[model samples]
Target: MKIYTLEELQEQDVKDVIQIEIDWSMAYYGKEEIYKLSQEISKCFNLDYLIINLKGNSIGNEYLGLLAQNITKCTKIYNLELILEWNSIWNQGIQKFGAQIQKLTNLINLSLDLRINSIRKEGALYLGQAISHFSKLQNLELFLGNNFVREGAVMLLLEIRKCQDIQRLALEFNLNSIDDNDLQQFGQNILNFKNLKEFSLDLKQNYELTSMAQSKLVNQIQKCQKLTCLKFCFENIDQDEEVYQQILNSLYKIKRLTFFQLSI
Candidate 1:
């Protein structure tokens, strides 16, 4: 069943749900309401697919942090999407949520949106290490934009190297404090995944942009032989189309990925 609000969720039985979407995005529920709603969701032990949207709630870690602590009972969920953008989740909160999520070892497709939060390097490392344990994960979407991940972005990429079965991957690292050296490190190991058919990398508005950095990154991306769909996002380019051609040329020369899009 698909419910859109807290009121709708209160009317249903959580125990029998296998696929549920409770999107309370942009809600203004206070602490009591949030707590009560999470308590009900924690009872969804049989849930296999869950999409809980509470973005822009401004309640910080109280949103996912509450659900993380209470929802660890669901040990067999295969697909989960936790959308909590603009919620101000910090280091401890992400670390805790990451630990709790690690318990769900059956996840195949997972989407985690923690955009515009205050996550730093240590938190990012812990979160990455936790996700790297998902040996069954095939598709992963991790959005950490507008934060201060810095070298933590590289650390996350390194940990994700363990998800060798991931076929479709989309990562948003925009406006994080990631530097040139970190990008190079991420690019170095980008081709280790052998099953990638689709990939999206968003790194817009990063600290600095240089020709050598972009070139090195694309060099590794071009080596992905099975990619039929590839997207790249970056900003502050002096010549947009020029950069696009340089990357596009590298891909077209591959003769396998005729279906590709480059977003500048």
Candidate 2:
């Protein structure tokens, strides 16, 4: 549980590190400062777990690419969590960042927070291709809420479906342009995740979702006999009581289900 600031990390030598948490949030560091810090952190060869919180940082494509390049050098990292919410990163930056992330083939648990960014379909596709490189990933939590992702969501889900060992997944795509057909495709891809136990899908504020789509999604999810915990948020959709009841009936079919939540 060791925490280090950018200044501290740059000044001292980190060795034999098992876990390290780097907090660059709220810091007014310039691009060069971030690049130097990233270079320093890349020297730690024994680091297994790394957490980086970059909330409120105005990191651009070049600096983000530099940091990602250094991160790719840390081959021993197993669990990686990055918080880059509220940044100015766009599609090109995301693509470069994802290219570097693909080098971390040893990663098992990955959590990426790119909420409130300017990711579009191209960015989502790049990120999805990068995610497909993690064949051994077990736990994944991705926050892409409030972005321009629509058909890109389906592309990302298709890549995630390739990870056969993924057990727990929490995806946040609220306030996007995901429609009924896109959600149905997502549900269809999810059926391939046989090892998935806990799953949460947040599609709130997607005005295109209707009762028919909700039923179709429920029918697909009911096939996941291994699911123990399930959550769905579909607020502002056009679902009625009958549709809601159908979703509940589908949930009842999962004998192993312990936790169930639905918001409309």
Best by lDDT: 2
Q: Which stretches of candidate 1 lie above 4 Å from their native place? A: 240-245
Q: Best candidate per TM-score, number?
A: 2
What is the lDDT of every predicted structure here? 0.79, 0.86
lDDT of 2: 0.86
TM-score of each: 0.92, 0.96
- Each prediction's Cα RMSD? 2.0, 1.4
Tens-digit per-residue lDDT, 78-194, candidate 1: 898988888878988887788778888899999999898899998788888989989999999999999899989888888888989999999999999677888888776678778
In candidate 2, the residue pairs with backbone N, CA or C atoms under 3 Å apart (3 or more residues apart, or in different chains) clash, namely none
* Lowest lDDT 10-residue stretch of candidate 1: 253-262
Instruction: In model 2, state the lDDT of residue 225.
Output: 96
Model 2 residue 234 distance off true place after TM-score fit, in angstroms: 1.2
